[model samples]
Target: MTHRISCELAEAPLAPGEVAIVGAGPGDPGLLTLRALSLLEQADCLVFDRLVSREVLALASPKARRFYVGKASRCHALTQEQTNALLVRLAGEGRRVVRLKGGDPYIFGRGGEEGEVLIAHGIRFRVVPGITSAQGCAAYGGFPLTHRDHAQSVTFVTGHRKGDGELILDWSALAVPHHTAVFYMGLANAGTISRQLQAHGLPASHPVALVERGTTPEQRRVITCLGELVATIAREGLTPPTLIVVGEVVRLADTLAQPAAQVAILAEGEIRDRVGERVAL
Candidate 1:
């Protein structure tokens, strides 16, 4: 029951003074790449985010120094500038530093920005990509991002607005048919997302799926339509780390879903009562 990598294709060890910007894919330790696991095992210092699962962290070197720099809406353990500076200082100290992110570092995880800071300071670093939330959520939620009959293309969007300002995105582009749109950090703006897409020509009854805490044991998949998206979230009490998937492909979940003990699937007109009381929609 021991898994081993062949010596011929063995990963290079993380060197001293080198920063490894690694992705800890979508709350599932099993989804981690061999390179990411190797780097984590070799890392002497780890600066990680909130979404990086505890199970993933437990795989790292027991002696590694851990720093929590998780960011949530309106709350941050450390600012982006401070995190960048911390990486620079850690690398300067000749430590095998790992800047672990929740999903693919480059996709909305701000790995590019952090890399720029590292380069500016003449620090050595390497990026190890992880499976982004969109892919993870789609697969685990029993929906495909693209299908020949449903969707031809997929788009990833950030649902977070800039400090009380409106979400300024190309509505016409997003509301197109035969396309899947996955929004990250968008739980707060569910109403706006529902309205904008509708205004842009997408019907109110367009299929939508909300995957909460995707890829984790507590994962919940809520199946609803664009018009009832806001209400669905409120009724389900879905929280942050949820991914909003809007497209016809979401309807495929009814037939394609794989049963899981921990996953709860709630579809329109048929919702499970998690609490003691049942409230029909």
Candidate 2:
């Protein structure tokens, strides 16, 4: 079967000296959008991060100059200032720079900060939103972020901070019942996150799902509860790129989730169609 990946509605050719800040979606290479795929083919320079999957990076133009500016929890390949400066320098040299980030660039990916810097420097730029981790992770793990029966709203928060600083999240608001709370980059702070939520009045038995390497072949959806979150993570040896989803909706995973291997084999059209319908609500 000829799987024709269409670019019929592609955007205008990427202009020289313009920065295209694109989201790489979650780990699945299949989630790359037509626009994001087009930019990868046209970019003169590709700046990507750690969370971006190798399969997605392989899609970039062979002639494109690749620069890895990935940052781990405590280790940064290039400081934020350095990355911003690099983008400006690349543009000044008349390069069509593609700043690819894992998940949606705007959602906790610091695309906004980068865009502000570009604007300050009077640089032309475009942002192509990708499937945020919360969306991709939840969908791949087979759970809804919001459900009329389970949750009324969803909140996304980061669980760790630079150096020895603690995560300053509004636990009281997060502890509210009938809502979903997702913690990005929360694996390391699982103990604190679980403890804080419980302390803030959420039931100790509150449902929690730790999605590791979400939407990829290595994906592991560890179903547990708030009380055992820290222990579960340690027992499973889960790593970064794990999204922590806490709420009653997690219980639906047993019935809703199709494993990543199963989902990965589906046609692109089928994947998009199914995911689109779920997200529209």
Candidate 3:
């Protein structure tokens, strides 16, 4: 049997004079939200980063024009001024623009800066939340952000700074109680992080999880403790675009790794009394 190619995009529609900063969701095309897909479908022009997956780009309507602003790991990204100007110019031409990023737009993705520019220009814009690498990586790597008995609160932080010269993270603060702590773009600083966190009182043996490539088929997850995490990642040859998670919840990640299973158990065990059959297994 032969399958026919449909030029139709599975994206959604958009209104005129509006800009959508969409999260492409940690390199997995399926993680695209319905609203995000809609904006892509109706987008007259898409300003995307070089790191965006081809699969996600392919979802934009066939008629929509695609522009690459070229922001990749260790590569040249357009100046912030130029990028913001491009967005304004595109919208000035009455094009429905989609600023698509590799993961969630807000989580270290620079969507806030773009939003500031839009506000200054009085351009209408919307925010579309997508699965950040933290969520995506943790899910695909079998690490749960929270475990009932293990953790209660989760924190997300960036490991590197664009302008800062050194590892300037607040080590003392991060060493506090947490169910999980996720560090984005942190693979390169894994060693420094380990040393600093340990120096700040975080146990050297605290479990650390490094998820590379996140939700993609090429994804890899390394489960190790802080003391050995650096050596383990180096010996194993993992690359950037990775997330680092540290905490007690990681110890129970094996059991809560299943999305459907976690939901089911939460429903049947915890919410049964208050939510009744609504949460019934």
Candidate 4:
């Protein structure tokens, strides 16, 4: 099977001894940018994260060497230091390397830290932006991040805590009305998130949307209130990789959601099954 991509801006090749830190988007291969695809096809060494979908990886050249450096809550295949060293070493060997991260590399993907390492070692690299999980989950989960009547501002927050420590954040600012707050990797801190927002100013009845494995065939979206976030997760058996969106904008999902179940069925049945067949020729 042979495939060719035609684009006027495809002339810039991945030069040897350079690294391309590319975002793999939020699970969906179709969400990948053309520049990201180009680099994947040209990469000789691919370093990828856990959240990066296998479908996106399948689009890469089969000849490329793959290294999985996925990091989950408290479980890491490779330490951040080791991953940094690996990238530096690979680029030093004159390899066209691609560091594939889930969602936008700059949006809490640790691409900035990696970029700093590359710069310190004088390694040439480029960053290709992809759709962040907040955007992907919000769109696919059938809600707008911001609406004229619901929310006027949107904020992205990290839900990760340090060794079970308290989540230190500006609850006063976050609890303001007419603003949407999206928490990444926040499933574990649902109780704290709910409490803090209410303690500051927001009501317990604030609408919250829990999107599990968002933008994928297995995606699940649950609408609840801030007070019930913790209980909702337990009841629904939700896990990590879930996003928590807190705002009135989530109410729109009742009328706007395209039915996550149907979307999953179509993605698994038609899209996933036929993507290779259509693109292989």
Best by lDDT: 4
Off by over 4 Å in 2: 1-10, 259-261, 265-281
Instruction: Assess each prediction's global lDDT (C-alpha) against the native.
Output: 0.86, 0.85, 0.76, 0.87
Those runs of model 1 whose alpha carbons end farther than 4 Å from true positions after fitting are 1-11, 260-281
List model 4 lDDT by residue over 22-120, tens digit each.
999998887889888888988999999999999999999899999999999999999999999999999999999999999999999999999999999
- lDDT at position 118, candidate 1: 96
TM-score of each: 0.91, 0.90, 0.83, 0.92
- Which candidate has the highest TM-score of all? 4
State residue 188's C-alpha deviation in candidate 3, in Å.
1.8
Q: What's the true lDDT of residue 178 in model 2?
A: 93
lDDT of 3 by residue, 160-220 (tens): 7665578787788788666578888778788888998889888888988877776665566
The lowest-lDDT stretch of 10 consecutive residues in candidate 4 is 272-281
Tell me the spans in candidate 4 whose CA falls farther than 4 Å from its real position: 6-11, 259-265, 269-281
> In model 3, how large is the Cα lDDT of residue 25?
86
| Number of backbone collisions per candidate | 0, 0, 2, 0
